[model samples]
Target: MRLEQADPKRLVAESYRIEGITDGECRSIFIDWALSLPVGVDARQAIKRLLAEYRGTAPDHPMTAVLRAGLHKAPQARRRGGARGRRI
Candidate 1:
């Protein structure tokens, strides 16, 4: 996805401008960015692009971990079937 396609475009832009931003601050921004994502957008891919663009300049930045965490976060599994399926 292109940068413009990212949710909260202003937040993402501001995040990159932060000089020596703290881990906590990055976490907050990350949450905003995540929440702003549009449906059907590949979060992992979006994050990867952001990481590559920003993290490339500072691989050790605290934001890297936060973004990486988002990429690796697994979706929760939904339970199916009704009580009738149980061994009664």
Candidate 2:
């Protein structure tokens, strides 16, 4: 089903549910989902993009928070140094 046919928020919520994510974490995941898309891809494609990258993995609230703040910061915790990476 397409994102327009399916609720974008609900899709995101379901993704969170599958990953056992919290509500606060949803916003970040949703944002990351949005950013991952090509410039003009539709919402369905956007959701698909997010799912491809994030689905199946458990949500990390702290990581979500950083990603929500800015995609560039999401990997900071995983970096060998404190340098920020490229933005999503």
Candidate 3:
């Protein structure tokens, strides 16, 4: 799905509602998601990508610095292999 096809703010609001998250928690989640993208992507683009990936679903938890770290690690993990050189 394309980022232009979805309303990211609305998606985050609805997902937060469905997940029963407090307003503060939701804001934190939104901010975290916004900051967790590739270097060249802006917050708006980050939110759009997140909305595309997580449409109709609630995030597992409020966003955090750790979540951003994991996002950074994902691409590296995809390229690296296990001890036997098998893809993880």
Candidate 4:
């Protein structure tokens, strides 16, 4: 009963089809793909599915690399040398 595809626009899928696609291009496409997901859809799960879909077919594709990178959550950066945290 799913209403939409995990990749509604197939941006990720198309990225793999592109010739000589770069990581930067893949990144841009990934961003658009992520934003295009229907509200309430789980992005993590979508990413996993996308990875599985392309992994075997295009293991070295830039889009596949981008999707794999997307699976990881970046660490929060803390401010350094901030005066606000200092007190007299």
Per-residue error for 43 in candidate 2, Å, reads 3.6
For every candidate, C-alpha RMSD to the true structure in Å: 4.5, 11.5, 10.5, 2.7
lDDT of 1 by residue, 1-88 (tens): 7776754466766876789899899899988888888888888888887877777787787887888888775888876578865646
Off by over 4 Å in 4: 1-4, 77-79, 84-88
| Steric overlap count per candidate | 0, 0, 0, 0
- Candidate 4, residue 27: Cα displacement in angstroms equals 0.2
Per-residue C-alpha lDDT of model 3 across residues 15-73, encoded as one tens digit per residue: 44554555566666555545544455555445545544564354454532223333453
| Residue 56 displacement (Å), model 1 | 1.3
**lDDT over C-alpha atoms for residue 22 of model 2:** 62
Assess the local accuracy of residue 28 in candidate 1 as a C-alpha lDDT between 0 and 100: 97
C-alpha local distance difference test of each model:
0.78, 0.48, 0.47, 0.83
Candidate 4: tens digits of C-alpha lDDT, residues 5-50: 6788878777888899999999999999988998888988888888
The total of clashing pairs for model 3 equals: 0
Taking all chains together, each candidate's TM-score versus the true structure is 0.70, 0.31, 0.33, 0.85
The true-versus-predicted C-alpha distance at residue 35 of model 4, in Å, is 0.8
| Per-residue lDDT over 1-88 for candidate 2, one digit per residue giving the tens place of the 0 to 100 score | 4544323444454555554556666665666656554455665544444444443463364433433343332444553444355433
